[model samples]
Target: MGTVWPDVRLSDSGDEAPTSPQRSHLIGGHDSKSYLAICSESAVNWLKARVSSADEQSVTDIVTRLSRHADYKSTFMCPPKLKQFPEPDMQMAWKYCQEYFDNRVETLFGAIDRRQFEARLRAHLQDGDNSDSDPSWYALRNTIYATGTRLLLTRTGCDAKTIHESAMQYFLNALSVHTQVLFARQVDLTGVQALTIMSFFAENLLGSSIESMLCSNAIRVAQGLRLNYEPVSNERLSPSDRFVGNRIWWALYCYDKHISLRDGRQSCIDDDDISCALPERQASENPNKFEIFMQMIKSAQIQSLIYKKLFSAAGRRQNTIQERAAVEQLDQALSEWRDSLPLHLRPGAPIKKSSLPAGVHIDPVVYMHYTYYGTVIAMYNKFPWTARGSSLDNAAFGREKAVSAARSVVLATRYIDTDMNTTGCLLFSYPMTALIVLFVHILQNPLAPSAHSDVVLMDMATGHFAQLEFATSMQLEVQFVRDMAHIARRAVEQIRRDAWIDVTPFEAPEPAIFSPTMTGPNLNFMDFLTDDVYAV
Candidate 1:
């Protein structure tokens, strides 16, 4: 008899059947080649002999079982219905919409047209809860409410639990209409926008693989509408409409590339298939307004190149010399892109908070800096594992760049003024990656001048994660980081004590211990320590 797989349905109503009866096969095994995976390997190797048996087991659980794939099955279940509540007053509704536009618009690359959306929102409000209203618009409106409410939670001064519950209510309200919009006979751009917004919300709040699935759907819908192609002169769209279309398409493009990179999956939209033009600045618009959005598009393009040239299966097959050349070329491209940014917006440049326009939040600016440094880290993160023999020089260069970039990321978090609970999971990933690098760096050379200071930075990052745990459901991931920090602290203290006498320098675990051939999918805790499964 064939192996039996559990029944998987997409809805509670049992209206959707499983796409395949067999369980989904693991593509690259449970572990991915993402920075987080690299971090896990480093932690396990460093903590192998330093911690108690129970602590070692804890590390093993986090590495082998706490991955996103382990919980991805939950995504197929229908979202539970939120308890009904009175809708916010029209004044509050409009305020929430404004908050989303003022704060989130640039981060999402102007996913919605402000004037057009506001006009539609006014008309929707006039309809006064009519069920006849377009479901796509209804979903989009609620998602805007969800995003805005979460953003304002810190300022509200209400109980954090109350505010979080309210935000989740709005998110569920938007999801209530998702099926209608998804299965509509004639899917429109409005539906695509709704899906995209909801996907963003899901990523930040829900913390699941569902966000990627929703984004893939949005990409498909946009492609079906031919949004990937530049409009011909004969298509007869107004300049404003063309501009909105361009923004939406490029925004989806950026989201697709970033999500793919984050999840270590193939991108849904291929660059070769896209001919959409980048959004152009209108004559009346400030050049500075376009600066962040344009740079983000460029950043996304670079991310796409990085994955294809360095991380992809074909890229991985390249010999040491070829890979080194590719890394150098990509590094130069990234630097040139950074050099092209405005002075204040450039990574590590100090910005006066007062100079920001009224109503504009500092989150987007901070995120841009984080992204730049994170990209740099991502480019060189694999060097310690992959470097050997003739590649040691390249490894040294890569290590220097990666360490500096990681330090910059950890230091840059000081500028985040927003409540950590309200920020997305993506924000935490960068610092965690940096923390891992710092952890390994300390283990390698505990007596380095910066090692003690780096430990302080690691503590700060752990505190940041503690704050984040209040709102996020990703307890396993947060705990993993905290546990690693504990091990690192203990290890460093031991090294400090040994440094007082005639003691040998601490040496990093040999890279051969992490070879994939020595490990497989069914390893026990001790086995895992002996042969790290997360190695590239």
Candidate 2:
């Protein structure tokens, strides 16, 4: 494939373009490798010049020219034609489907124009029984209906296993429909919405690779259409079009930041390239979706920076002191954001707990708190104190703070609306990072306050990962989150064995997930009178 942007290495794993040979508009009639070289030289020099001072005119020109390249036009520039899906009227708009999303999913992601969507569906139905259908709208329709049905099933207490099976079927069926539509036509705005919905479902189902791939495609398509630019500021669009365009852009932006954090990779979309502002809320808006989503994007962006600078292979310079300072600043920033949230949205602010005994119906605040604490643990864990010999070097308050934050995260999970909302579950590494820090603490200081309690929490957290695995989303085949889960389990098992505790091993014997650690006695025992209490 020809280079889409010769100046930039867009992703760590350049999973953007197909690999097969094909003629491109930019390099038409030229040999593939030779044209690639020629284009690379030209684009790189242009980009280098623009980097020094890239105004709106220059950036727009660059994106415009690149969007026309036949090689990646589908991925980044051109919109695909849409197809109609013929669902029974009953399935088209089930009772309270939109209400469920407005109450739950909408609060998390404000990427869709719910009112406009319903209006379109109603108009399509009213057009006439004899009128030909528009297949383009079908993908979005099915995705929307599928999401609403899943949430509805959970809230209504369809059997626990039944809910899982039924919701999975709805999502899978929609996925099939969406895939076929895109394969048959170019990707359109409705297709982007459907893919975003699928990405949400992938994370909720604990699917690792699929979630990332879906978001990558969604963002790629959004950029192709230049949704990253301010629609209202541009004269080509009306006020309503501007509103819809900004909402989609911000939603895609948030999703990309999330996928980057999950994979510990640099973000696929550069912050410098985005010109759209965060979506604004009207005074009468009830749910505050705009505010929450805006803050969530900011939080995810901070976390993504943490992942890239401290964890990614390309960023392997482990300056503990420097990274510690960065983490501390982020911790403070998160706390400030939480404090600014409205009373109902803030953690521990009495969000529907007294109203419902069942955990399925919840205010989105519960998950927000859980995620924030988990992020805190991820930051605190980066200190050298987590390694074996750092016990004596570790400060009491820092470790105490970490333990408290870990427990807060553990307790918050109980109220996490498992059946309806799985926002935090999408990023399995967040919880895994918390549990590993606790594991490190226990291994380093076994007799500390409630030592086994930490181990118990880690064990419980590992069980939350049962559903996360390699469920395919199109052709993506990586098990990124599942790998983290396997590593966490083995780490917990090792903790038990090293402490001379009973270990019920994994059913199947296999190679260790982590390379063997070179171990030797590093701590001097307190030679005591009783001896048995300290024995290991």
Worst 10 residues of 2 by lDDT: 514-523
Tens digit of lDDT per residue, candidate 2, span 129-201?
Answer: 5222333355566555656666676667664445455455455445556555455455466666767766765
CA lDDT, every model vs. true structure: 0.62, 0.48
What TM-score does prediction 1 earn?
A: 0.79
Using TM-score as the measure, which candidate wins? 1
Candidate 2, backbone clash total: 8
Candidate 1, residue 430: lDDT: 65
lDDT of 2: 0.48
Question: Against the hidden reference, what TM-scores do the models get?
Answer: 0.79, 0.61
Model 1 Cα lDDT, one tens digit per residue, 378-424: 77765344344456334555665666667667665655542423345
